[model samples]
Target: MVILFNKPFGVLSQFTPEAGHKALDEFGFPAGVYAAGRLDHDSEGALLLTDNGPLIKKLLDPKFGHPRTYLAQVEGQITEEAIKKLSSGVEIKGYRTKPCIAEMATEPENLWPRTPPVRFRANIPTSWVRLTLTEGKNRQVRHMTAAVGFPTLRLIRTKIGNIPLEGLQPGQWRFVQEKVI
Candidate 1:
């Protein structure tokens, strides 16, 4: 079975335990299923988990280059130059990212309010940017935005490959077809 979970903010990607945080069990899934790709504790979005060996194998294989799309709320007034830089790929943590698509995105009208909301600065502004990348790296989205001079205040992954969040609330999970991913 392939499971798509809308992992909540501050939740660990793995079903394992850690201090001061809830794991996947709190959201509940069948035992023995492992996440195909990981979302960091600070990031919220579509997390694919599956028990099907073939599905797992395909997702884990780097050659597939499945796209991961995110709506990132970043600090500062993001400029066209910044978007172009992002599209061209910026170096983060000594690794130069592959070229990808980056475009200005409006704040999602259907977005649910975040608990313990991002800090609001009366002077500074935040803008939404849509980022699509095929490569998954540790804190890559956040790092990439920071490298472009607009630190990410919030990051939400909306899709993994062709599967989208599709109105799943935080901490919810649903079984999906292999082809949907």
Candidate 2:
């Protein structure tokens, strides 16, 4: 069985234990299921878990080019030129990301309030943006925004392929059946 979960901030993606922190058992999933991909311990959003290895590989492999969309809250004012640069592609670290969709959020919807909250600056403003990427790299979204001069304050994944975190709250999970045909 496949499952879609809205992982809350501060939670580890695996069921294993690490030091003094809580694990997936605290969230109550049956044994044998595992997260297909990981969200950083600080990031909050949609997480896919399943027992099927082939399905998991298909979802996580960059070769598939499955688009994953994230809602990012960035520091400072965003310029039109910056948006264009992000859309065209930004040199992140030594590698260049493929062209991805980046746009200002027209309305605030489907976003969950982050736990512990993000740091706020009295003078600098934060803008929310929707970023869709076909590749998943280590801290790619955060690095991309930083490379362009606007650092990301908060990053949340909203969708993976056609499945989304719809109706799931922070720390919530639901079983999703995928059609084999």
- What Cα-based lDDT does every candidate model obtain? 0.89, 0.84
The list of candidate 2 runs beyond 4 A from truth reads 106-110, 178-181
lDDT over C-alpha atoms for residue 55 of model 1: 79
lDDT of 2 by residue, 58-169 (tens): 8877888888899888998777878888898999989999999998874257566777889988998988778999999999999988988889888889888878777889
**Candidate 2 local lDDT, residue 115:** 70
lDDT of 2 at 22: 53
lDDT by residue (tens digit), candidate 1, 23-114: 88787798878888788888898999888788778877878878999999999989999999999999998899988899999999889778
- Give the poorly placed runs of model 1, Cα more than 4 Å off: 178-181
